[model samples]
Target: MKRHPRRSVPATLTALVLLAACALVAVVTIQMLLGETPWIRYDTVAAALHGTRWTDTVTAIVGAAAVLLGLILVLAAIIPGKPVVLPLRGDLDSGASRRSYRSTLRVAASAVDGVSDARVKLKPRTIAATVTTGRTTIDGLADAVRRSVEERLDQIDPAVRPTVRVKIRAVRKAS
Candidate 1:
């Protein structure tokens, strides 16, 4: 089963609020059972409910907040989440994350001679590589990097073979 990422913030807050409310109710019930003064007086609550008149501004604010909260919950439930990792052919049981792919591409590109450093970005449909070369200018370095990255990607066998784009830059010497 594919595991979905959780939106924990709202869920946790809601749980805490519910727990507190339940605890308060439990405390009130226990007090009434034991014949002790209640933490919340029922008479005060009844009076407040029966006699209090809500102002127009307060009612409007409360209604807007409720509507906004409902809309947020609905939208969160409706939207589909993007997976952090792309599934590989070999690892059906376990998947490789995009970060891992990026690192692999960087290493592959850096393996090429004349490439001092490599930076790789893996997108849904594109693999971008930037390589820095030493003082010597290597002809076709960009093409070589692109080919190397493409080859590495072929080994992974991603769902979609992204187009490889390579950019080569000469390393700047310190003055």
Candidate 2:
């Protein structure tokens, strides 16, 4: 299953633009029907269109901007977003959200000895962990944390096993 987040921004902006355009037309139609002048007259717009030349810098700039905006909107609508939930192995019959998965790995790293704190960053195929210890000398803390994280990852049994990388940071001693 391909599960990814839907981009709401483009849809929202498009809806708002359509709504405004429709409202503007309705307002103008009502004014014209009432035998009064509209805020923006269609004849004025026609005159402006007739007066402007394609070679004019202002017209060229406006055309370029419109084209760029259209391309951006099309790309935004077509591009796939990052997956929010990663599927687990078949036997598990479940999925883990990015947040929950990262937290589980962080808990494993923090459970190790001399690990005061753990910060986990999840990428597509790598789980990078930074563990902070109170001790100034961290000889094998990074390896221990990596092993802890990897063991927990195995237990989770995700569909794709990301490599574990652990970085150890020690709290500075008081002067």
Question: TM-score winner among the candidates?
Answer: 2
Q: After superposition, how far is residue 19 of candidate 2 from its true place, in Å?
A: 1.3
Q: Which ranges of candidate 2 are over 4 A from the true structure?
A: 91-93, 173-175
Candidate 1 runs further than 4 Å off: 1-4, 43-55, 90-94, 132-139, 167-175
TM-score for each candidate, following the candidate numbering:
0.71, 0.91
| Residue range 35-110, candidate 1, lDDT tens digits | 9999998898898667645666766788899899878877776665655667666535656776687898899999
State each candidate's clash count: 0, 0
| Residue-wise C-alpha lDDT for candidate 2, range 79-139, written one tens digit per residue | 8777788889886467888889889999999999999999999888899899999987788
* Model 1, CA-based lDDT: 0.79
**lDDT of every model, 2 decimals:** 0.79, 0.89
- Evaluate model 2: give its lDDT: 0.89
